[model samples]
Target: MNNFFEVENVDFVVGGNTKVKNMSFSIEKEGDIVCLLGPSGIGKTTILRAIAGLEKIKNGHIKLKGKILSSEKINIEPENRNISLAFQENSLFPHYSVEKNILLGAEKNPDNKDKKVSFNEIVDLLDISKILNQYPHQISAGEAQRASLARSLLSKPDLLLLDEPLSNVDQSQKEDIQEKIKKLLAKLKITTIIVTHDSYEAFLLRY
Candidate 1:
């Protein structure tokens, strides 16, 4: 796999305490999904937050495509790093319609002056076309998750960071939802990293 985002000996310290240990990993354009597989509170989300520039790394380096995105001496803001992150919740605007929220990121893009990806495509792909006129509060957790995925992808992000996307969905629907998400990601040729505690879900991502 060609290296895209590399984290070397990264550390996060706060209140004179170290949270993240000496961590090192590399994610690339052609790489398979790598799970951070560990128990809760082991700095998994910390790693993603650090990469997204939401948390400050006190040491080591984070490089994206050979460019230093974050380091001890320098820090790049989240929006400029092409690192699109979708949290477990709070990914959409409660007031704006689905189409508006999906195209929100395109406004910051240098290209796509007219927002090339049509709103209907995203809505249909996510199976939320009927809910496009509805607010975020009106959708199911699964529907909201799909909208979040679509929103992040519409940004044309280089790296995707998902945090337990299906955690809130029903157990019976987990496998099916994961399959759909995986298919959409493959279709888009997007580099994705999914953070989940389910072993079976992670196993399916190994391909």
Candidate 2:
């Protein structure tokens, strides 16, 4: 049986240093959530970047739905990959309100008729409705993270990659937000790969 997503013997190098070497993994089916869990600065994020087509792999193959996305000779552009990546830093636009930032994701493909989730649904799920008008600087770090996630989900990506999604969330509300995100991904049946340094988070998201 073919896997839905596969990364085989991949190497990712940056600034003349090899960050990830000979890594291999796969998500066998759609709607599956896979976590890359390890200590910080161990190339977990690089793997996600490779899969999302943001980083070029030095060797090996990254495949999605039986199509080769990246290899020694083939590198697909990030925009053409139909993948959404939510950065760890919650890279929201400083000038735009939270609502506008989130809406930008949906605007990527205005002609797409089969949206997996609506704007209201994502806002409600992530509990960011109250802060829609607030700018990224106006909200807490946790709120910014959720807003970033909301934007990624709204894009209706074939593959969603989240980088340390809940890292900035308070411990008190971390699990709650994780559960909500897990359920939302399941409901939408989105194939997801989350990069996290916390084993507990990996367990929560994967199982």
Candidate 3:
């Protein structure tokens, strides 16, 4: 049997600089959560981008469920990869309400309508139901982060990538939010790879 997901001997280059080199990792089963822990500028985000098909890898291969996603001779478009990436920065459309932004993700696959997570469930878990009508500019950084996360989760992707997922959360609520997210992921059983600089966060969400 093939591994669920694999990144082997990958190298990333940008602007004539080598960002990452010889990186290799694998997720052996579905619903496994893997954390890529490192400091800023160390290419953690780059790795996520590469896996998501947002960036090209200069060497090696990325395979999902035994299908090649990226390689020297082939690069799949991001939309065709069945992967959702929650960016480190809030990326909601400026003119769209929070609810609309989240809905966009689910709209990607009409055939998976019944499989999508309930809107209310995610908003309630992220505590963003009250701000459904609010735009991204009107919410706090933490709120925006949660909204982005909600969108990603609603997409029902085969693989989920979260970049600094809780970086903007307030200190008092950070731990609580973390616990809620952990439980939510477990309940959903979505295969995930989280990128973060926090060791504690990595440990809490570790496979």
Kindly give the stretch of ten consecutive residues in candidate 3 with the minimal lDDT sum: 108-117
Candidate 2's TM-score reads 0.94
**Which residue ranges in model 2 land beyond 4 Å of their true spot?**
110-115
Q: What TM-score does candidate 1 reach?
A: 0.85
TM-score of 3: 0.95
Better of 1 and 2 by lDDT: 2
| lDDT for each candidate structure | 0.74, 0.89, 0.89
Which candidate order results from sorting by TM-score in descending order?
3, 2, 1
Error of 1 at 177 (Å): 2.6
Candidate 3 error regions (>4 Å): 113-116
Per-residue lDDT of 35 in model 3: 97
TM-score of each model, in listed order: 0.85, 0.94, 0.95
Give me the overall lDDT of model 3. Answer: 0.89
lDDT of 1: 0.74
Question: Pick by TM-score: which candidate is best?
Answer: 3
